[model samples]
Target: MSHSTAFASQADLAEKKTSFTQLSANAWAYTAEGDPNSGVIVGDDSVMVIDATATPVMAAALVRRIREVTDLPIRHVVLTHYHAVRVLGAAGFVPEGAVNVIASRATRDLIVERGAEDMASEIGRFPRLFQAQESIPGLTWPTLVFEKELTLHLGSLEVRLLHLGAGHTSGDSIAWIPSQGIVFSGDLVEFNAGVYTGDAHLAAWPDTLDRLAALQPQQLVPGRGPALRTPADSLSAIAYTRDWVQTLLQCARDGVAAGHTLQQVYADTRRVMDPVFGQVFIYEHCIPFDVSRAYDEARGIANPRIWTDVRDREMWAAIQS
Candidate 1:
């Protein structure tokens, strides 16, 4: 098979430019051109990092960016979810200081359950994102786990971590800086990028998004795109993510209602969503995974199936063949 015909993101090895922009006086965003983003919060004494990069090597770049502005130790690291691409970089933060890795209890459970399988799957799928796979020592386990919400203070800065509901994953959480009116929405909101719903809770995602929007953030750092600097852009990102999820789920629902096979459902979904979201980042790469999850949800699959590397290839072949 040609490289293009292979599994999603398999051959995408080109480098992307990284942007580290300050969102507020204390909050910053390290965004690549649609790759996973990390949010930085500089408090009065120390620093907190949200969403570590894919590997320790990749995360070193984020640390360098953080050092460009502040020399305070990175005392806290927060995992918004259990995806390897987002959390495996916790190792990188250790060198800076005694990092207190934090996550929702559900996320920690997921990491313990499927973190290995996910690491292999993600590395195989997105080579460019994981710059140095060997640098990843092992699964990232959070030292600090919370149930619904946790509040912390980095000196005078107040950071509220809340698990609104399930969207990207069962443990999806967002870092809210209430005083700054800034929110670091993990994968719950993607701006101008295709949503990756492979491990998503499609049915509950919208309501989770509703709760996220209710916070009325003035600035928002999305998981995969540039940081939104204004309240208008922040709200628009939420709307965009909501529409994408709704559209994909609706297509899956329609296919299931008409008694279509998975392949047929994928085809129908691509036919409609491609024209609209085809130009977005990772559009082609995400559709197969997104449709599969959506179809399973439409057919009453409550929990997302574990996506191993073998399963990834099998599913890709089933849909692409």
Candidate 2:
């Protein structure tokens, strides 16, 4: 499409209405033109929402949707990862002491160390998502921390949260409701949305997908796309995410082996990935930084370097210019 045509297409997409996509009997997925995802799992007596979007105002809107679905008190708010957009709006679910917020231990550590900078970066990227910054007091800390896995019974419902290993982030968790056969694979499985492998473990992501596939979820709520209803759809989601991560990893490895600078690798990545994933959400804002981070990992760099505000501006200017 021409540039003007593409702009019109995006404008149409943005002007669409926001509604909940129900995958299974009581499982719900939320999609706005925003950061991260919000999932609502309604149980017997209460509801558990996964990933709180970006801020309170955004989350309040999600809450309104949940109220539309079921009147169950949102007893628990779960954090699938430590991203600012996902966890900061947790207060919108319930107050600190009243509701149990869950997250992986590594994610908790990441929030403490890099939370502020990440919050700043993501808000800068997706302004509409973080509707009211001042409404956010600070970072939302998880009240309950799990190492690898934890199972909880909310009244009569069974909710399983598993840390499948390092993939999208060091502390990614997949919430599975086996009885309902619905798995909330946050950011780990992208559908039409881009696979955002910035703080990712390139080599480990596939293994995590392998684990996700083994579970054979009948319904999947992906981080940023439409809900997957059948087993085929679920597997396809995981496969596409795996393929995207591996493609970037191999590209970065090849570029590094050829002694390419970060800029050269970024250019090559866009040259390659644009044909497949270039039109997804935040593709322009995310791809170059994703390439740079993957390049750093390919060069044997471990533990993502902290992305401070100044560093973000410097990186964006370097990549965009």
Candidate 3:
């Protein structure tokens, strides 16, 4: 099979303007035109970074932003999930005083299971995102792991890291700050961007989303896109994400029930998804993987298969065929 569209992101070499928007006194969002975002929480004495960027060099940009506001050491790095784009930059924060790398127990498990493959896979897909790819040391390991929920005090500021449920990945976590009614939702929530459910638990995504909505955060820093500043916008982001997942799963289910081929399901899913989400950032890059996973889950595959550079190409070729 021939290559198709070059991953849709290989050509996305244009730089995106980065924004460091302050959501609250303690919370700031590091967003770039729909790229994965990182969250910053400043306490009285230390700082915490949520979702490190794709590479240490990329993470240095976040550190620059953090330093502009405070000289406090970055004491913690939280992994909302195990995606390489989000975790590989943990080491970048080490110099900034980040000692403890924290993640949910399940996220740590995923790193052990497929981290190396994912690291190579993601770097290939989005070359521009990994600015200085050579700077990456290896798969990021979480020094501190928690089960369902873990709460920490960054010098009196309370931050709750909760493993809400399976959605974007089996080990997705969200950082909630009750004091400011702010939450940092990793890839579990996206606004004005493609919701990549390439390794998602589609059937359980909605319910997990429900749990996030129950938090009623006043402001939310999603995994991508701009920060949601209003409670209304936060709800909209959750609703939009749910709609994306539900619509794709429904299309996959319909196609599978009709005994259609993967290519056929891809066409069917696009016919429905494109009209609404086509214009978003990375929509093209995400569609193939998202549709493939949706098809798998619809066919009763409970766990998402590990993605390798080879498997990614094979899957892409199959759908293109």
Candidate 4:
């Protein structure tokens, strides 16, 4: 099938080349051409990982990369959100002596509400990312959950995880290292890649981006791009994501105001978004879902609806029709 006509990501088969880039003394990023990125923080005593890959088998690759830098035990695995692609790989770190999986209370709530459905939906949507699908035990549950913010001491280095606001998802959280002026933004910021808003807060996303920018991070690890080393590059990533969100929402609003159907709205959104984001990785895969969610939000859907495998096919058909 042509990439444009195929179901989400099913046509994508090529493996991405991964890079392990150090952003600070304690901060590192594992990015893969435009695939989901993971963050590694090597503390004085222990280590912390943000956003596990899609499956336990996939996460082993990340573990190997971490071992190249430090033998420190991975004590903590932090979930930036409850997406299956991000959290289902927690079990992979268990063999490395990772004891605790951390996430915000809102994240845990999301897992309770729709984690299973999301897992099934995502596995069906992006087959390649799942790698060894049989290796995933089940939904990843956080052993430690907190509200608003939580502070952890990996020996002497302090890592702060804060749920600043809802953007990517209502449960979105970020890891901030105050001493090093570094931040790990999970799927909240995308640079030179498609911003997936399939389960996002379209209207609140820009404001959440503002709160993330307020941290004034000297270095940043975005969800889907290369690590930003300079403050200027960090801010530019934020602006890049903000512009995408705002532009997408505006297109949805304009289409809805003109009484366009979902298909019509999708076409209208593509006309505007494609010119700029068309060449980005996963652009073809993400735009359909992004347009669907934006259209729903513009028509007064406050909360994102659950997406199951059945729903995924139905939506794909509706847009394609």
Local distance difference test scores for all models:
0.92, 0.81, 0.92, 0.92
Per-residue error for 145 in candidate 2, Å, reads: 0.3
- Model 2 has a clash total of 0
Going through the candidates in order, what is the number of backbone clashes in each? 0, 0, 0, 0
lDDT for position 261 in model 2: 84
Q: In candidate 3, which residue pairs get closer than 3 Å at backbone N, Cα or C atoms, i.e. clash?
A: none
Model 4: lDDT of residue 280: 87
Q: Residue 215 of candidate 4: its Cα lDDT?
A: 90
Global fold similarity of model 2 (TM-score): 0.92
All candidates: CA RMSD (Å): 1.6, 3.3, 1.8, 1.4
Model 2 off-target regions past 4 Å? 1-16, 33-35, 95-97
- Model 2, range 14-82, lDDT digits (tens) per residue? 433465888777688886543466788888888888998778777888888888778778888889998
Residue 245 error, candidate 3, Å: 0.2
| Structural RMSD, model 2 | 3.3
Stretches > 4 Å off in candidate 3: 1-4
The stretch of ten residues in a row with the least summed lDDT in candidate 2 is 1-10
Superposed Cα deviation of residue 16, candidate 2 (Å): 5.8
